[model samples]
Target chain A: MNSASPPDLLTRSGSGLLNWLHGWRAVFRFAGVAIVESLTPRTYNSATRSVVLKQIYFTAWQILPRFTLFAALLSYVLIQIVVDTARNFGLADYALEATIRLLVLEILPLMTALFVALRSGAATGTEVVLMNIHNEIQAIEAAGVDPNRFEFIPRVIGGAISVLALTAVTSSIALLIAYVVVYGPQYWNLPDFARVVAHIFDLPTLTILWAKVLAFGLAVTVIPITEALAAPKKLFFAPIAVLRGMVRLFFVLMLIEVLSLALKYI
Target chain B: MRLLEETPDAALISDSLPLRANLSVLENVAIVLQYRRNMNYDAAADRAWALLGRLGQTDSAFKRDPDLGSEQRFAAKLARALILPQPIILIERPGLLLPDTHYPAFLDAALTAVEDLFEQCWIVDYTWNEPLYAPR
Candidate 1:
């Protein structure tokens, strides 16, 4: 009942592949434009700055307290497990380094990316999809405002900065929690903790981490926007756009994490 | 609408050209000044306030699109369009945006209030609504 000619199936599959390639091409193209526009001095004006400030306030400053507490709790638990297990295995000397590497270099950054992606990235995608459906983007353009320069690029800038800020705050807190879990809440172990930190966070690792977090930040916002722009201008497409954006964001975040790990360790 | 689409200075106010839901009415109006003229936020807000004042809509400055009445929303849209430099105002089907009121009277009052700000004003509507714009 479902029989189809091989040539017809081949053509359909070929078109599907072309569509997939075109989708990715558009995403990268938009990302490049956003980056360029963000860097151009002419793009930063009163309106763009206002949008950037608002985006940072909503994305980073709003959820900061709750997110910090959650990160601290998770860090404490993970560091406790790592330290206790290492002590039980008669290798307590390496516990701090292991915990530092696992928590700071990997887990915390990835966690912050996921958190921002789920919260702000989804919201941005849905908003853009709705705006597209409403023809608001076209309207803005018709009013003599470049939507990319005034609206979208500013959000990308704010999102990247927010991810960096959140990652820095949470990672610093996690480091403090890691120290207390390892050395039992005293100043005597400060030198040892500093030594471990310095050892684990050499120049190359720091560079890789900073680059990775920035990449994650850009991906979270950029991917959603790109997908939402690609979506058909219809009300029912909003949810689908957000879903696709979130999935792509998650994949890209994981890829960045894996790549960073490979660069550092392998 | 199609005829004016290619005009470089035309500003179209229609159902399709809605206020950004995420922004306050003041922001929706001031953004044009901020982006096109590069005016700072305070100056843009002040100008937007002045424009809204002209329409007796200062009270609705901080409200969002969802909270706005039809007349207030139309005022905001009109103010936003007028903020453009020497704009050719194009109002497409005022009835759709102001369904519950006598849109002709509202449009007349609104345009008369800011007659000096725009270069010219145009209205596109269905033939059935011709009598609404006829001399009353």
Candidate 2:
């Protein structure tokens, strides 16, 4: 066997880098299409409507009770820890602001996305892969159906909606819990709590929060479907597709969190 | 109708797999009419039911893929194909399902039933005397 020369090694590394970039480009392309198609009113007929309903049912409705309870418990624990630590350190004055910033601005949205991604993202990715392997997508195309409109777009919309709804529910509960934990559920601290919340969630912070949550929602579902679509049409490749999707999803979530934090603090 | 392209305008009914296994029969058919024919939900469902009724598939109309038998699935897929208002309809390996003896009679009856909405129905099967055959 002949070893590669310097030029050959450089060429091989260059091609590998190009292939990696091309892979990411395809993911973004699919995401753009999903977003554009989802916004089109023509995409939502009875068929896709049913799909969207089913997706929401699976992604949001089924897990609402347990997921909210878990989030509330987690929020309570984090708030208690932060408040107690701040009081001990003689920084109690900043406890409310810090708690809100931690839970509302950061943790809750990412948690909701991760929850939905683990449950629904994996399922959607596997389903798409199986459909691809069995040529169901091809069959849909043969039937003159736009799979993007009927299949992927609705699922993406459903996933995004699910993320947003869950995030709202959990974040609201966390805010309530934060109040109770700090102000002892008394009505006397309403103005104080409101001022802190309003200050922490000012216009720019609110905008960033919404943008970050939407980004998380879109990434959780869109990345999985994109990965599944990119996978080779084989049964063995399905698991690999999901694994890659989940890993990419985690990276994306962390990246969003980091960027949001940088925007807010740095 | 370019059969070799990645996204074809024509509907394909494959003998080897359910057309869309994740969807119910009605959804599978309605998706075709809704997306391809650009009809609304009610209109697409109405047309889907009418087509299913015409094909004697009203029984399996609402059933999911796994619940339907081989013949019911085939009929559902055929309904999906016929729902498209395309000029050329491609039927692959008709010999696998529509044996030569039943090919002409089946095509004639179905074509007549639909009032010849399609101009050409290309049935591809290697066993046929020719590589490609079109019903007149």
Q: For this target, which candidate reaches the highest TM-score against the unseen true structure?
A: 1
Which sections of candidate 1 miss by over 4 Å? B85-87, B127-136
True-structure lDDT of candidate 1: 0.89
lDDT digits (tens) for residues A95-139 of candidate 1: 999998999889999999999999999999998999889888887
Q: Write the per-residue lDDT of candidate 2 for residues A92-182, one digit (tens) a residue.
A: 9999899988898888999898888899998999999899888888777655567777789899999999999999999999999999999
Task: Report DockQ per prediction, comma-separated.
Answer: 0.79, 0.47
Q: Model 1: per-residue lDDT, tens digit, B1-136?
A: 4645576667788888888888899998889889988999889999999999999899999999889999999999888888754557778889999989988888888888898888777777898888778431
Tell me the lDDT of model 1 at B48. 95
Docking class of 2: acceptable
Kindly report which residue pairs in candidate 2 clash with one another. A142-B10, A142-B11, A142-B12, A143-B11
Q: Using Cα atoms with residue i matched to residue i, what is each candidate's TM-score against the true structure?
A: 0.95, 0.87
**C-alpha RMSD (angstroms) for model 1:** 1.9
lDDT of 1 at A239: 96
lDDT tens per residue, model 2, B54-104: 877799988998798655666687787777666666666655655434555
